[model samples]
Target: MRWGTFTSSNSVLLLIDHQVGTMKLIQNIPFETAKRNTLALTKAAKILGMPIILTTGTENGFQGPLLPEFKELVPEAYDARIARSGVVNTWEDPEFRAAVEKTQRSHLIMAGVTTDVCLYSPALSAVEDGYPVQAVLDASGSPTELSEQLARQRMERGGVTLTATNTLIAELARDWSRPEGSELLKLMVDDVLPPVF
Candidate 1:
């Protein structure tokens, strides 16, 4: 796969299944760590003025509603969130796919709870459908280390670029001196990074 840079103008943020009950299934990383990173990405994306697409799976069932913080951070995306009835792979959901297409962005930055399922399937599907996808690993997790590893390998093999929250933020920012970059750096300090001392 050829390497490329994703800019705020060319990329859309797609957060999938970051729902309450679904998040509880993540065991590969501390739950708070995953939540924090995911929130940080949301804030960073909002600061950069990127289009965001939010999705949930069977919210009325076990999946539960998407994390309320998203609604507070990017209320428009949350309000327009695609609520999948029973679709496991978000890419297969027509509404979700259409929403992403409507963004008119070529690259996708995605994160989801339970990396093995909520993230794995749709990411691969998106890649196969010819979209350049970047999966934010730290903002997502799996039920176990083995599942996470296997999913990562599969995603890599399937052409999804695996990335971390800080890396994605820095890549998008490109220059810390810019006002948006400075705000993103502040987001990193306040939400994603530990104290320097």
Candidate 2:
């Protein structure tokens, strides 16, 4: 299927476990890259006017709160700190599930700190619920390259389409003629696309 089939209005962006808590153990994808993609996602979501749902697990003392940058990105999003423990799978969070439902969008755009535990779980759950899920794989981190591959494979099997942050931004832009076009192009150049052109 075409990757950009889900437009901004029909999509819901879910940022799972982007907390300073989960940021500590990330390994495979360099922390800087993950941070950039996460930040890019937040910025794109805000620009596209997509519904933003943010969730954190054990943000109180066990790990840490969501990064200040992300919180600053979408100060109006429904931010919730779920009380459940054990499991990077955020679909189990009541608040997360409710927020997803509230968005009322059938297409889900997802990314998380850990590829397997954080990104994979919610992708699978959404697939089972008959929703089209697009996972930003590179934006999601893992403990190792091995785990990252496995996480991506599992989600693919479950029908989650994988994409990178740049591909997604370009797809959404569709053309550099929209009102937000130039600004988005600048964003891709500054964040996703390198200075190769």
Question: lDDT scores for all predictions?
Answer: 0.92, 0.80
**lDDT string, candidate 2, 1-197, tens digits:** 34348787889888887778688768987788888888898788888888888777776764578878865677777344344465567886766788788888988999887786878988999888888899997678888889888988898988899999988887777777887767778898898765785
Model 1 pairs whose backbones collide:
115-141
Where is model 2 more than 4 Å wrong at Cα?
Answer: 1-4, 78-87
130-195, model 1: which lDDT tens digit per residue?
Answer: 889999999999999999999999999999999999999999999999999899989989898878
Name the lDDT value of residue 176 in candidate 1.
96
Ten residues in a row with the worst lDDT in model 1? Answer: 1-10
Evaluate model 2: give its lDDT.
0.80
Give the winner by TM-score: 1
